[model samples]
Target: MNDQSEQERWNARYADDSYLFGTSPNAFLASQRHLLASGQRALAVADGEGRNGVWLAEQRLHVTAVDFSPAALAKARRLAESRGVEVSFVQADLATWEWKESSFDVVAAIFIQFADPPLREAIFQGIRRTLAPGGLLLLQGYRPEQIQYGTGGPPHAENMYTAAMLREAFRGFEMVSLVEHDSVIQEGAGHHGVSALVDLVARKRA
Candidate 1:
């Protein structure tokens, strides 16, 4: 689907009075929270409904949540308000967003899927360029094997990720952790129950 169509689809999905992905950080991120540095600027890309972004803000990280859906951004704002935390929301397509270089101390990407190889490469490059020296990146996404689990994730196998894919994407970075595992995700209607996923944490060399 084109960017506009994709945005519209997500907007419609989130337009209802339901929290699609629930109000919590990804299981992998929450598990590794101790490894994250405090008081650093963080960016949450494709942060639909602001769950993870709001959680980051609550952790005292300066946060900016970016997504193409205004509906999702509106819900994100509401979530931030309820949590009594501040998070900057940017409505833009990640494929075209002018990501800044060396600007963020941490970049968190959870469940953001892209089937187009070029677009995926571009997004990964953007993530790499947007990180500050010694910055860290925390990522979690469904693996192709997830189709068997039938829990959640994109229908296209190409949209799914693998540890090898992430290792190749962030080749130059210091890989702190990279693994494919099974875990129970209790997000909401969209993401729930047992899931097959790849999780990674990499740091930019200073």
Candidate 2:
């Protein structure tokens, strides 16, 4: 898909009075809060509607949320203001974004599977470069089995992630934990039901 078209599509989804995904942190992210420290810099990739980013700010993590949709970023800012927490919301396509090396202590990427294989590889590589040494990386993506569940996520198997794929992507990093399982997700109208989940927590070597 064309990058512009993808951005426009997401913007349309976010062009609503309410958040597409309700204003709460992802389950995987909430579970790993203990790994984050107050005042640590965090980056929320494709943080549509700002749910996770706002939650991180509430946890006192200095968060920078990036997405391709202006409409989404606007909603994210509104969510941040309503929560009375400050977060830097940047509108950029992650594929081309100039990810600063060793800039963030935590990189929280929830469910962004819009990239194809080549772009996904670039994104994975950029994710590594963007984190500070020993920085925690929290990620959750749908597994191929999600197609059967029909709860959420892309239909293409290639877009889905596996534990082995994640392990290989961050081979040099400390694999704090990785798991594949099924869980009920009640985030919002967007994603709600029994879903196949792949959760990973890895850290850049210090």
Candidate 3:
């Protein structure tokens, strides 16, 4: 889809008053509290409704949340305000967003499975280029098995993640950790049920 169509599709998904993905941070992200510290510069990619970005701000990280949907960004702003946290909300298409180099200390990419193979590759490259030396990349996504489960994420199996895919995508990263598993997750109406998931935590070399 074109940029406008993509934005329209997501805006429609987020048009409702309620958050599609709920207000809490992703489970994998929240579990990595040990890696977070005050004053770190963080980027929350495709941070719809600000849940992850706001949580990062609450952790005292300077956060910049980027999404393509204006509707979602509006809700995110309200969420951040209500939570008494500050997050820089930017509405930009990730496919074209300037992924500044060596800018962020931590990059959180949770459940961003909208991209097809080509766009996914761009995003993977963007994440690598944007991270500062020794930076942390915390990402989680549904695996191909999720298609059978009929849970969250795109129906296209190509959009799903695998350990091998992630390892190759972030090839030069330190590969802090990577795992695949099945779990029942309830993250609002968007993601709920026994799901196939993969989690990756990689760090840039200093």
**Per-residue lDDT over 1-206 for candidate 2, one digit per residue giving the tens place of the 0 to 100 score:** 78788878888888889877898889899999888899999999999889999999999999999999999889999889999999999999887899999999999989888777888899999999999999999999999899898877778888889999999999999999999999999988888999999999999999
Tell me the tens digit of each residue's lDDT in model 3 across 1-206: 67788789999999999999999999899999999999999999999998999999999999999999999999999999999999999999998899999999999999999988999999999999999999999999999999999978889999999999999988889999999999999899999999999999999999
Pick out the ten consecutive residues of candidate 3 with the lowest summed lDDT.
Answer: 1-10
Candidate number achieving the greatest TM-score relative to the actual structure: 3
Residue 23 lDDT, candidate 2, scale 0-100 = 89
lDDT of 1 by residue, 95-181 (tens): 889989999999999988843667788889999999999999999999988888888877778888989889989999999999899
Q: Which stretches of candidate 1 lie over 4 Å from their true place?
A: none
The lDDT of each candidate is: 0.89, 0.92, 0.95
What is the TM-score (0 to 1) of candidate 3? 0.98
Which candidate, 1 or 2, has the higher TM-score?
2
Model 1 TM-score, 2 decimals: 0.96
What RMSD does each model have against the real structure? 1.2, 0.9, 0.7
Specify the highest-lDDT model's number. 3
Worst 10 residues of 1 by lDDT: 113-122
TM-score of each: 0.96, 0.97, 0.98
Candidate 3's displacement at residue 183, Å, is: 0.7
